[model samples]
Structures are given as C-alpha cells and as structure tokens.
Target chain A: SAVISQKPSRDICQRGTSLTIQCQVDSQVTMMFWYRQQPGQSLTLIATANQGSEATYESGFVIDKFPISRPNLTFSTLTVSNMSPEDSSIYLCSVYSPRQGGYTFGSGTRLTVV
Target chain B: AQSVTQLDSQVPVFEEAPVELRCNYSSSVSVYLFWYVQYPNQGLQLLLKYLSGSTLVESINGFEAEFNKSQTSFHLRKPSVHISDTAEYFCAVDQAGTALIFGKGTTLSVSS
Candidate 1:
C-alpha cells in the first residue's frame, strides 16, 4: 500500500481567498482524483488529474473554481479559488494502486471559509 | 456511468449485535464493489472489495459483504459488531478503468 501525506490537515480562509491542498503519494501513479464532501453530504468527484495533461473536471465542477495540478505521477495539488461558505468542505485526494488492489486516499484537508 | 445507493443514512446498534448495511449500484458495464469505512476526522479505509471470482468478500475486521450481480447489490454485514466498529461506511462502485462512484454513506453508531 502506498502512503499519502496531505499537508495542512485543516485550514481557515477568508471568503475571497484561495487555498491549495497538496497530496504526495509514496509511489508514482498514473492518475489522481480529487473529491469534495460538503457538510452532511456525500463525496463528489471534482476532477481527475493526469500527469502532463489538463485535468478532467466533473459536470458541476469547473477548472476555474477548483484548479488541479499534477506535476508528476507521485504528487498533485488542488486549489479552491475564491472560497465561499458553500465551498467549505473536506477535500480528499485518491490514487488507485494496482499493488494494493484498491484506492488509497489522503488524510483529507478540512477547509472553512469565513 | 455508475452510481451507488446506500439504503440507510444511519444505523444504531448495541455492542455485540448483528448489523447490516445495504448498498446497491447501477452501471451499464461490469463493475467492482467496495466498502470503505471513515472514522471520525480520518481518511477512508478500504474494508473489503469484490473484484472477481468470489461473491462474498470478508475484511480482516469481521466484516463481510456479498455481491449479488442479479440484484446489483453489495450489502455489508457483521455478525457481532464492537464499539470500535462505529464509523461512517461508504459503498462505492467502479468500472474496469474509472474512478470510484461513492454512495451517500451510512453512519453506524454502536453503543454498549
């Protein structure tokens, strides 16, 4: 199983500010997924980041709002731009590991917009 | 496309009692089913998964889920749940080469 280190487990930001959450995997992976879980809601896929390519955003998610960066196979970052109260949620990164036979998730970054 | 449905939003049970969390999914193609547990302020952990061969998959923590292809269901069960078993359980499904689609999740509260 690959270990993931997510930075700034929790953060608080102004409504107009932005926050970037980083996820580092112990091993390289082809794709990384970003998900958002709003208060009392289910996890929703934000986008799929592939190394050296533009991210593929889900239906409701836009690149302007939730920008994703996959510089390499082992690392990715998700940025929440122009945060709002509604944007406050738990952001998680995941990677599918063939050796683990499952998806490995980051600890998650809890964001609060004030 | 794929989607998962977890029948219950919450399940309250006494310690050492049997419990079941129902899950169903709809997908046009063959899919893999999985059960994930998320403890308070923690990341999601894979409980068990049914990829192929066996219809029934068991986790190391005394939890098992049976995949019923005809019914399109994969319900998780524990014969005797401990207090530590209390957590939010999510049912997810994915096709051969896609991201997982998760359910709303079931919050299991076990008390003594």
Candidate 2:
C-alpha cells in the first residue's frame, strides 16, 4: 500500500491568510485527488492533480481560490488562497494504491480559520 | 457520472450488537463500490470494496457488505461489532478506473 504523508497535520490560521498543504506519496500514482471535508459534512472533491499539468478542479471550486500544483506523480500541493472562516475544514489527498485495494488517504490537514 | 446516497445520517447500537448501514447509487455504467471508515478526527481508511468479483466483500476487521446490482445498493453489516467499529462510514462509487463520488456518510455510535 502506498503511504501518503501530509505536512502540517493541523493548523490554526487567521482569515485572509493562506496555507499550503503538501501530499507526498510513497509510490507514483497516476491519479491524485484533493478533497475538502467541512465540519460534519461529507468530503467534496476540490481538484484532480495530474502530473506535469495544471489541475482540473470541480464545479463550485475555482483555480484562483484553490490553486493546485502537481510537480510530479509522487508529490502535489494545494494552497488555499485568501482563506476565510468558511474555509475551515479538513483537507486530504488520496492516491489509488492497488495493494491497499482502495485509495490511500493522507492523514489530512485540519485547518481552522478565525 | 455517479452519485451515492447513504440513507442514514447516524445509527446507534450497543456493543456486541448487529448493525447495518444502507447505501444506494445511481449510475448508467457499471461502477465499483466501496466502504470507508473514519475514526474521530482522522482520515478515512478502506473498509472494503466490490470491484468486479463477488457481490459480497469482507474487511480484515470483521466488517462485511453485499452489493446488490438489481437494487443498486451496497449495505454494510457487522454481526457483532466492537467499540472500535464506531465511526463515520462513507459509501462511494466509481468507474472501473476513475475517481469516486462519496455519500454524505453515516456516523455509527456504539455504546456500552
């Protein structure tokens, strides 16, 4: 199973500030997805990061507000641009690990904006 | 495109009791089903998945679910659950090699 490590497992930030979350996969994955789980809500797809290309974001999410970068197949980063209280949520990155028989998710970045 | 529907927002049960979480989906093409568990303040872990084989799948941790094609449902069940089994469970569906669409999730509470 591929192990995914997300840096800054949790953070508290002020509104208008930006936080960058990084996901590192032990093995190269063809597809990597970024999701945001609002408090007590289901996980929502934020974007799909493709190696060496611009990310494809889902509807209701914008490239300007949630910029993504996939420098390589094994690593990606998502940055919350100009955060707000409404952006407080858990951000996670997952990669398909055949050995895991499912997707392997990062520990998640718990963000709190005040 | 695929979408998942989890009928229950929450379920309460006692230790050593049976529990079932219902899930349904709508998709035009054949899709894969999966169950994921998230403990408190944690990331989701794969519980089990039904890709192409048998409709019934079991997790290493004693959880099981059956995929019903006719009903478009994949309900999770546990005969006798432990306290550790309580968590937020999500049902999702995806194409053979595509991304997944997750349900809202059901919060299972196992009491003493």
Candidate 3:
C-alpha cells in the first residue's frame, strides 16, 4: 500500500482566507482524489487530480473555489480559495494503489474557518 | 454511480458482545463493496472488501462482512468486540474504474 503524508493535520483560519492542503504519496498512484467531509456529513468528492493536466472537478465544485494541482505522479495539492465559515471541513486526499485493491487516504486536514 | 446506505447512525454495545452494522448499496453496474474504519482524528482504514469470488470477507482484526448481491447488502459483524473497536464505520461502493461512493457512516461505541 502507498503511504500518504498530508499536512498540517489541522488549522484555524479567518473567513476570506485561503488554505492549501498537500498530499505526498510514497509511491506513484494510478489516481488521486480530493474529498471534503463536512461536520457530521459524509465525504464528498471535490476533484480528481490529473498529472500534467487541469484537475477535473465535481459538479458542485469549481476550479475557482477549489483548485487542484497535480505536479507529478506522487504529489498533489488542493487549495480552498476565499474560504468562508461554510468552507470549514476536513479535507482528505486519497490514492488508489492497484496492488492494494483499495484506496489509501491521508490523515486529513481539519480546517476551521471562523 | 453508486450510493450506500448505513441504516444506523450510532450503535452502542458492551465490550465482548457481538455486534452488527448494516449496510446496503445500490448500483446499476457491477460494483465493489468495502468497509472502512476511522478512528478519532485519523484517516480511514480499509477493514475489508468484496471484490470478487467468495461473498465473505474478513479483516485482520476479527471483523467480517458478507456480500449479498440479492439483498444488495454488505453488513459487518464481529462475534466479540473490544473497547478498541469504538469508531466510525463507513460503507462504500465503487463501480469498476470509478471513484468510491461512501455511506453516511455509523458510529460504534463499545463500552465496558
């Protein structure tokens, strides 16, 4: 299984600010996905990070609001732009390893926008 | 696309007691079922999965689930649980070559 190191674990930010979450995979992955889990809610897909190309965002997500960068096979970053209190949630990056038969998720970034 | 349903939002059980967490999913295509456990302040860990072959799958930590195609259910069960088993359990489904769709999750509270 591929290990994903995601930071900063958690952060408290003021409204109208931006935060970027990074996930570095120990090995190359077939696919990388970014998800947001609202308080007391299930995980929702934000976007799929594609290497060397623009990320594919989900229906409710937009490039301006949630921009994703996939610089290489093992690295990806997701930025929440112009965040508000509603944007507060746990952001997680997940990677699918073919050999593992499942996805490996990062520890997640708990962002609290006040 | 697939959608998962976890009937119980929370389950309280005594330590060393048997427990079951019900999960049901709907998908038009062939789908894979998986159970994941998330501890407090941590990421999800794959507990078990039903990719193919036998309908029964077991995790290393004594948790097992049966994939029932007719019922569209993959309920997790443990004959005996410990306090360490307390956590949020999520049931997810993925169509072949697609992203996973997760259920709302069930919080299991194992008390002494």
* lDDT leader: 1
Model 2, B1-112: lDDT tens digits are 7899999999999999999999999999898899999999777888899987888999998889999999999999999988998899999997864677899999999999
TM-score of every model versus the real structure:
0.97, 0.96, 0.95
Per-candidate clashes come to 0, 0, 0
lDDT per residue for candidate 3 within A5-41, as digits (tens), equals 9998999999999998999999987579999999888
Q: For model 1, how does the per-residue alpha-carbon lDDT over A1-114 read when each residue is reduced to its tens digit?
A: 888999889999999999999999999999899999988777899999999999999999999999899999999999999998999899999998776667888988999999
The DockQ-based order of candidates, best leading, equals 1, 2, 3
Candidate 1 residues B1-112, lDDT tens each? 7899999999999999999999999997888889999898777889999888889999999999999999999999999999999999999997864798899999999999
Off by more than 4 A, model 2: A98-101
Global fold similarity of model 1 (TM-score): 0.97
Task: Give the lDDT of residue B63 in candidate 3.
Answer: 98
Error of 1 at B97 (Å): 3.7
- If you score just chain A, what TM-score does every candidate get? 0.97, 0.95, 0.97
List the candidate 1 regions with Cα displacement exceeding 4 Å. Answer: none
Docking class of 2: medium
Residue B111 C-alpha lDDT in model 1:
100
